[model samples]
Target chain A: MSHQSKRIILKSFPQGHPKESDFEINTIEIKEDEVKDGQVLVKLLYVSVDPYLRYRMKQVDNKAFQGYKLNEPLTSICLARVISSKHGSLKEGDNVTSWNLTWQEFSIVKGEELNKLPSNDLPLSYYLHSLGMTGFTAYFGLLSVGEPKEGETVLVSAAAGAVGMLVGQIAKLKGCKALGIAGGKEKVEFVKSLGFDDCLDYKTVDNMDEAIKKFCPNGIDVYFDNVGSETLDAVLLNINDGARLPLCGSISNYNDTKEAQGPRRTFNLISKNAKMEGFLVSKYGKDFGKAQQEITEWLKQGKIKEQIDERNGMEKIVPSFIDLFHGRNTGKVVVKIADE
Target chain B: MSHQSKRIILKSFPQGHPKESDFEINTIEIKEDEVKDGQVLVKLLYVSVDPYLRYRMKQVDNKAFQGYKLNEPLTSICLARVISSKHGSLKEGDNVTSWNLTWQEFSIVKGEELNKLPSNDLPLSYYLHSLGMTGFTAYFGLLSVGEPKEGETVLVSAAAGAVGMLVGQIAKLKGCKALGIAGGKEKVEFVKSLGFDDCLDYKTVDNMDEAIKKFCPNGIDVYFDNVGSETLDAVLLNINDGARLPLCGSISNYNDTKEAQGPRRTFNLISKNAKMEGFLVSKYGKDFGKAQQEITEWLKQGKIKEQIDERNGMEKIVPSFIDLFHGRNTGKVVVKIADE
Candidate 1:
C-alpha cells in the first residue's frame, strides 16, 4: 500500500504580490501503515485557495494564527476521501472535508479532525463553494454579523468572488436591495445577473464616492466588506445610521508587502452610530449544519446559484492560487487534484 | 420677568485647533412670556466642554450629529435650575440637566427634554461627570461594547480624560487587569492614583508599540479607544484574540483639518477575531438609571474617584473648551456659570 503524493509547500515569503515561484511541489512516499490508531488515510479530491492564505504566509506573532512554516506543505479547507481508517467513526470511501487537509494527493490525518460530508447528489465541488466554509461565511457574515434587513440596501465588495456573490443573493432573498462594488465590467455584469440590484465597476469609476452614491442612493445599511482600503473608507462616508459592516478579509491589502497605512473614515462610525465586526468562518462550526440545510434548500429550489472557477490538474495549483490576487477568476477558486 | 442671558456662539470654524476667536459671547434679552405651555426657563448652572464638540464644529452630513451652524449658539449637555416653568412636569427651583441646553446663563427649553435631578445633595456639578453622561458613557461603552471579562486585560486610551478614566476604573471593578494610555506624565500619575494597574505615557514614550507591550504583557482584551490615530494603530497590534473595542470618540484626529488618511491597523481585527463598535452615549439613555445607581454606589463608597478640571467663569468658555485639544485638562472639563 505504498503511494507517492506530490504536495505544494511555501518556498519563500512573497515580497509584494504572491507569485507562482513562491510555492514548490515535493513528492513523498508513504504507506497505509502510517495511519496509526485513531487516524485515517485521506486521498485529496479538491484543494481550495482563499485570500486568507496570504495572511498565513506572513510571519505574524498572533496566537490565533501561527504563520505557516517554510518548506512545509500548506493546509486549507480541502475536500478529500478517506482511503483507509483505523479510527472509531470513519470508514474507507467516505467523503470528508477538513480545514486541516494538506495540499497533496493523500495524507494521514487525525480521525476527529475530518468531518464526513453528507450524501448529496449536488456536485462534490459545490461543498467547496455553496455548502462549505465559503457559503457558511456568506451566511453567518451576512445574517449574523451584517444583519441585512428587509427593504434596506446591502452593499458587498469583491461582489463576484466566492463569498461575495452568495452574500449579495442572500441579502436579496431577505428582501433587501443588493448593491455590489466589483473591479471589472464582466464581474459587475455577473454580480448584477445574480439578482444584485446594482453593481459598481470600481476600475472604471473616476469617483468612488459618486459611483457608490449613484447605485446606493439611499446609503448603505449593511456593507459586507471583502476588500478593505479606500473602498471601505468611501463606503464609511455613505453608511446609514446603525450601519453594520461584516468584514471577512481585505483581499486588496493581502498582496501588499507593507501595511497600507491609509486613513480610515472611522469618524463616520461615531457620527452615524455604525459598527464593524470582523469574523472568521471557523467560529461558526457549531451552527454549520443549520446554515448548510438552508443553503441546500436554496440550491435545490434554484433560488441561489454559486459560480465555480475550476482549475484542472495538481500541477497548476501554484498558478491557480496566484490568479486570485490578480483578479483573473471569479467565484470559488478550486483546483482539482483527482476525480471524485 | 425679563433677563439678559450671556451665550456662546460659533464665531468661525477653526482650521486645526479651535481658538478663543472662534467663539463669541452674545447677550440676549428674553421675557418669561416667551416660555410656551410645555417649556421651562432654565438658568445655567454648569456647561460641559467635551472632545466630541470638536467634531460638531465641522461640516458632517451625518443625521445623528449635525454640525454647528455659523453665527449660532453652540449647545451641549448642561446642568441647570428651572427659574420658571410653564410645564406640567417641572416647577420653579427644580434642578435639572438637558443635552438640549444651550451654552448660556439662561434659556427656555421644552420640559420633556429635561431630566430633573433627584436632589441627592451630591455636588450638582457631579451630574456633569460622575453621576451623569460621562459615567454612563464609561459604563455602557466598557460593559456593553468592551465587554471586559474577569482577569482579562482592559486597556483604555486617553485614560486621563472624562470617559477614559471611568472606563479603566470600571474595568478594574469588573475583576480585570486595567491598563491606561494617557498623554503626559502627570495625567498618567493621576490615572494610576485612580487605581489602574498600569498606564502608558504616549507623549514621552519613544515607541508606542513597545510602551503598550510593556504595560500589556498578556495582550489587550478590551480597548476603550478615545484617541483614534496612531495610538489606535499601535493598540491594534497588541490585542488578544476576540478583543472588543468600544470607540466613543477619536479626539486625536478631530483637530486635523484634513482627513488623517493614515493606515488603520484594522487587519488586526480579522487576525485576532476582534471587533470595533463606535457608539454614542445618547443611545443608552433608556438604561441610564441602572448605570447611574451603580455609579452612585461606587462614588459613595469611594471605590471610584472622578477628577474634575473646573473652569470658573462663563467669559472663559472659549479658552476652557480650547484647553481640551491642547491636552491641558486631566479630567472632565466643566465650565461653571452659576452656583446652586
Candidate 2:
C-alpha cells in the first residue's frame, strides 16, 4: 500500500523571530514494502510545539546543538501510533513514541527506539506532555537540580508554561512556597489556579526586582527559570542565601538576533552563595520510567493538574509554534495530526 | 605598664579606588590592667591586606558585611604574639591568630577566640597565606565547587594574586591541565613558573574569548573566577559541556559606583549544561582541618608553590591593599607589623 504524506522542511533559517516563510511543506510517498525488519511504521498522532525549536532554527557552529539543516525535514520527540511493525515485540495498531519523529503523517522509526505507551486512563495526547518530556523536564529540573527544601520559596518564570505550571505545583507539594512570574491577567489567573502561592503579572510591573521581592516575601530559595534575560536578572537580585537556579530554558533570548545586554546582577548570586545550573531532559533518560510512573500516579489522584491547548490538522503546527513566542497560547501547545 | 599603640581608623569612605587620605592613624593607650581575666594583651605580627577589606569600607544597609564606621579602628583576622595574659590557657610569648584583631601595635583579645599556631619550619607569615583564609579560599573554591576531574582543563583569572596562584598549582597537583589569565607580563610569567600549563597576559590581548580558546584547546571544564565582567563573559562563550564555574570574587566590579552592564553570554551555559556556584570558606569550617592537612603536606612535598609580597610596618597596610586593585603587587600581599 502507498501512503501520501506531507512534512515541513526548513526553507530558510530565521532572522530574528521565526516567520512561516522559513518553512515549506513537501509531499512524500511511503510504501508498506519499505518497513524493514526492526522498523515500525508510525503515524504521528500529535506534534508538540515548543520554544526549543527556535534554537534548532539557528545557524550555530557548536556541536552541543546541531541546528536544523536547510531543505531537511523538521523533527521532534512527539507522540505517534504504530501502524505496522516488522519487529516481533510490537504488532499493528500498537501505540509508541520515540525521538526524531518527523513533522509528517507517517514516519519509519527503529522499533528499538520506540517506547510502547502503557494502558492508562489519561489522555493519549498526554503521552506528549505530562507523561513524557514536558513532565520529566519539570520533575528533574525541580527535584534534582533546584533541590527545593521544605519552608523555602521556589519561584518560576513563565509560570503558565508547560513546564513552569507543573514546577510551581510540585514545589507546593514539596512543602515550599510557590511563586510565579507570568504575563498579563489571564496567565496569572491560570498560574494561581495551579496552586501557586502567588503569581506576578510581569507585563503590569515596573521594577521586576521589587515586584518579585513583594511576592517572594521570604526570598527565593530555588528559581526554576524558563524565560531568561531580564527575568533571570531580577531573580538573581531577589534570591536568598544558598539559592539554587535550575536553568530549564532561555525562551526570551532564543528569538534575539544580536547579543543581549543586561544589568550584571549575577554577581549578587556570588555574594549570596547561590548557584545556577542548565540542564536538558534527554540526559536523564535512565530515570525517565520512574519519573513518568510518579507523574502518572499524580494525574490519577488528581493531585496534579495539566492543561493542553490543542489545535487540529498538520498545517496548524508551525502557526501554533509561532503562537508560543508571541505568548498567544497557554499550557502545552500541541497540534493533533489525526484521530486514532 | 602603659603602652602607646597606633591603629589605623576609617577617616572617610572611598569614592573609587581607596586612597591613603581615606584612613588616619590614631594613638591610644593600652594598660596591662585592661587585659582582664580571659583576655590577653597581644602584639600584632603580620596583618593580611586583602581586597575583601575594601567591602568593609563601604557604607551599606545589609548585614552580610558591616562597613567600618568613621573614626573607628580597622580590624582583621591577623597574626599576633601574647605580651600579657589573664587567661588560663595562654601565657606570655604564645603565638596566636584571631578574628577582629585591631590593626594596632597592641590589642587585648579573648583567649577563647584565638587559634594557637602549631610549630612548623615554614615562615610565620604562611599562616596569613597558604595556611589561612587565602589558601582555604583556593582549596574549597577549586576542589569542592569547581570539582575538576583529572585530565580536565582548569582555568583561573587573576592568576598571580594570593588565591589565584594557589588555585592553579592545586589544579595541577590534582592531575589537571592548568591555565591562567593575568594582567601583565610579569604576573603571567609568575603564574607559568608556578606550574600553569599556559598563561594569557589579558592586558596584551585584543579579544579574550579568542585568546582563551587558543590556550584551552580541549575547552575549559572548570573556571575559578576571581576577575568577573569581560573575562567572565569571555569564558562563558568558550565553555564546554558540563563546565563548573566557582565564583570566588568579582574584583572587576567592586569599585563600580553604578549598576554594571555586560554581554549576557551566561545563556550559553544553558545549552552547554554548565553550572556556576559561589562559596565562602567560613561555611566549610568543619572540613578545614582535613583540607589544611592536605595543603600542608602538598607544600612540604614540593608539590605546590606559594609567593608572598611582604610590606614592612603597619603604615604599609593601607597602601598595599590599594596596590591590589592597581595590579601593583604580584603575590599574597601582607604587611609585617612587628618582629617575632
Question: Which candidate comes out best when scored by TM-score?
Answer: 2
Candidate 1 RMSD to the correct structure: 2.2
DockQ of each: 0.60, 0.65
Model 1 per-residue lDDT at B182: 89
Off by over 4 Å in 2: none
Q: Which stretches of candidate 1 lie over 4 Å from their true place?
A: A32-35, B32-37
lDDT of 2 by residue, A34-77 (tens): 99999989898989988998888888875656578999999887
Clashing pairs in 2: none
In the range A137-215, model 1's lDDT, one tens digit per residue, is 9999999989888999999999999999999999999999998888898999999889999888899988887877777
Give a tens-digit lDDT track for model 1, residues B24-90.
9889997888999999998998988888888788865545765799899999989999999999989
Q: Residue A18 of model 1: what lDDT?
A: 85
Worst lDDT run of 10 residues, candidate 1 chain B, spans B58-67
